[model samples]
Target: MFTLSSEDNTNFTELLKAVHKIGSKTIAKHAQDVDQKARFPVESFAAIKSLNLMSAYVPVKLGGMGLNVEQISKICEVLALYCGSTAMIYSMHKIQVACIVHHCMQVDYFKNYVKKLVSEQRLIASATTEIGTGGDLLSSFCAVKESDGQFTLTKKAPVISYGEAADDLMLTARRNIDAPNSDQVGILLTKEQFQLEPISGWDTLGFRGTCSSGFIVTASASIAQVNPVPFSEILSQTMHPFAHITWASLWSGICTDAIDNARKFVKNSVRRNPDMPPISSIRLAEVTGSLNNMRNNISASIKEYTEMLIIGDSDAFTNFGFSTRINNLKISSSQMLIDIVGKAMMICGISSYRNDSELSLCRHIRDAYGASLMVNNDRILMHNATLVVMHKEAR
Candidate 1:
C-alpha cells in the first residue's frame, strides 16, 4: 500500500538534495531576469526537466520517483526560495498531477499518461474559471459537445496560467449542451486536442513567469479522456485541498526568503551600531514569530491532508468542516504572505525599496501580493461564511 507521512520523508532526501543543487545555481540565477522580463522561467523548467522532477511526485508504479504530499510540498517551498513564479508554476502542475494519481488513475488513459511522463517532460495547466461565470468555478459556460464517443469544448477562460506553453490542459465543462451549468466533467486534453487563441494580456504585478494570459480554449477529446466521475466530486476530493497545500507551501517559501532578508538586515544593523538595537528589530521579531506560525499551519495542513489521503477517506473529502479548514488555509496563508513581505521590506528600509539594492524586495513584494488575489481570498471567505454555521465543531 502507498503511504505519505512526515516520518517517511527520509525516502526523498537525496531527491531533494538534487533539487536544491539546481535551485541554488540555476533557478536562483534566473529569478531576477524572469521577473524583470515577465516571461516564463525557461531555465527553471529546464532544470526541472533535466532532473526529471516533473515525475518526482508521480508513483513508482508509473516510472516516477513517487514522493508523497509531505515531500512534494517541501520541493515547492524550496523552489519558491529562488523564484516565486517558478514555484507557482511548479505547484500548479503538481496539483493537476495529483488529481491524476489520486482520482483518475483508474482510467487507463490517465495511467498511461503517467507512464509517459518518465520519457516525455509534459507540462500540465488547468482551466477552471471562465469569464462568464462571475468568478464562480462551480458553474461553466462552456459545455462539452459530444457525439459517438467524441467530445469538444470551447471557453473564454479568464486566465490560463502557462496555457499556450502547456503540453496538456485539464479543463472543466458542462456535461453536455443541455446540461445545467453545474453539471460538469473534467477532461484531459493533449496539445493536439486543443487550440488556444489569445484574448487578454498578462502584464501584471507579479508571477510574470506564469504567463497566465486570457485565451479562448477550444478542445476535443475522446470519451476516455473525460473523468469517469463528476467534476464537483473530483474538485472536492482532490483539487481543492491539493491546491491549498501546494500553494501554501510556495507562500511559506516566499515568507522564508522574506524573514531571511529581514534577519540579515537586523544582524548587520546591530553590528554597525554595536551599542543599540534597531527600532525595526521588534517588528522583525514579531514577523518572525508570525512566520513560524504561518509555516506550522501550512505544514499541519499538508500532514492532515496526507493522513486523509492515506485512509482513502472519501467521506472526509465532502465534510463541511474539512472543506472549511482547507478553504481558510488558503485565505490565511495568502494574507500573511503579504504582511511578512512588507515587513521584510521595512527591515531592509531604503535598500529594499530600490529595485537595484542587494536586499531589495521589489520582486518579493509584488509576488506576495499576487497570492491573495490568485484565487481571491475574499471569495473563499464568503464561501466559508455560508458554511461556518453548518460546519460541525471538532471534538
Candidate 2:
C-alpha cells in the first residue's frame, strides 16, 4: 500500500497495495510452516499467482504488466517483509523473466511464450549452476545436441530452486557438441520437456521453503527453444544486476522487519522504566542507521542501473565499473543483513533468540546467512579484485 513517491504511477501504486495485502494476510501466515517443513511456499505462491504477476517484467505489448526492474524490486522488498523464501522465489522468477524478455523476446517463439506466460501465470526457474562447474554460472559441462530440428540436453545441476514447482525451466548448456564450455546458450524448456531426477535434498538452516535441491535435469525441446542472445550478454546485462538489486531489496526488507522488532523491544523496556531510555535503545539506533545505509546503497544502485537502462547505456552494464559497484552492493547488503539482524538479536536478548517469542529473529538470522552463500561472496570478491585492476577508476 506504500507509494515510493507522489510521482509514482497511480495504477502501479494500487497494484503494490494489493501485493502488500497478500503479503500480510496470506504469505506471512504460512511462512513459518513452510520453513519448518522444508517445503515450497505453496500457499504464498497461490496468493501471488492470483495477482497474475509472473510476467511482471514482460512487455505490456506481450500482455504483461510491463514493470521495470525498480518497480519489481519494490515488490520483492514488500514481499520479503512477510516471508524471505517467498520473496526470494519471486525475485528469482522475475530475474528469469527479465532474462527472457530482454534477451530472447527478439525471437517470435519466445515472444509468444512470454504472452503465454502472462496468460497462464507461469513460473520459471533457472539451472545455471552445474555440479562440475563449482558454482561458476558462466561455464557449462553439458551440451545441447541438435538433430532434425530438435535439441536435447542433460545437466547435473547442484541446485535448482523450486524446479519441481516451476512451469518452465530456463537452463544453460553449450550451443552444440562442438562448442566450448563457455560458449553457452540459454534454452527454455517447459515442464513437459524436462524431467528432474532429484540428486540432493532441501534440508537447510534457512530459506528452506525455497526447495533448492540438486537435480539431474534431462530435457528435450525444439531447436527454437534456444535463445538468440548470447549467454554471456544475458549474464552480464540482465542476470547480474537484476539479481543483485532485487536480492538486496529483499534482504533490506528482512533487515527492516528485524529492526522493527528491535524497536518494539526497546520501546517496551523504556515503558517499564518510564524515567530513562534503555541502553538497548542505543543499539537500536545503531542498527537503524546501518539499515538506512543499506537501504540507501541499494536505492542508489537501483537508480544508477535504471538510469543507464533508460539512456540505452548498454556498455555500462558490461563495463568493469558498474559491475564492480553491483558486486559491492551484493557484498555489503548481504553482510549488513547479518550485522543488523545479529544486533537486533542482541538488543532483544532471549526474546529474539527464542523460537516461540513474538520478537523471535531465529528465522530472519538464518535466512540472512544464505545471502552470503547465494553465489559466495569470496568468489565475487576475487572477481572484483581483477575488475578493479582492469578498470583502475571509480565513479
- In order, the Cα lDDT scores of the candidates are 0.87, 0.90
Candidate achieving the largest lDDT = 2
Task: Report the lDDT tens digits of candidate 2 across residue range 365-387.
Answer: 99999999889999999999999
TM-score of 1: 0.95
Model 2: number of backbone collisions: 0
Candidate 2, superposed: residue stretches over 4 Å from native? 1-8
* Pairs in steric clash, model 2: none
Question: What's the TM-score of each model vs. the native?
Answer: 0.95, 0.96
Model 2 residue 121 distance off true place after TM-score fit, in angstroms? 0.6
Best by TM-score: 2
Q: Worst ten-residue run, lDDT, model 2?
A: 1-10
Sliding window of 10 residues with minimal summed lDDT for model 1: 1-10
Put down candidate 1 lDDT per residue, 93-190, tens digits, no spaces. Answer: 99888888777877898888887767897899999999979888789989888889898789999899999888899998898899999998888999
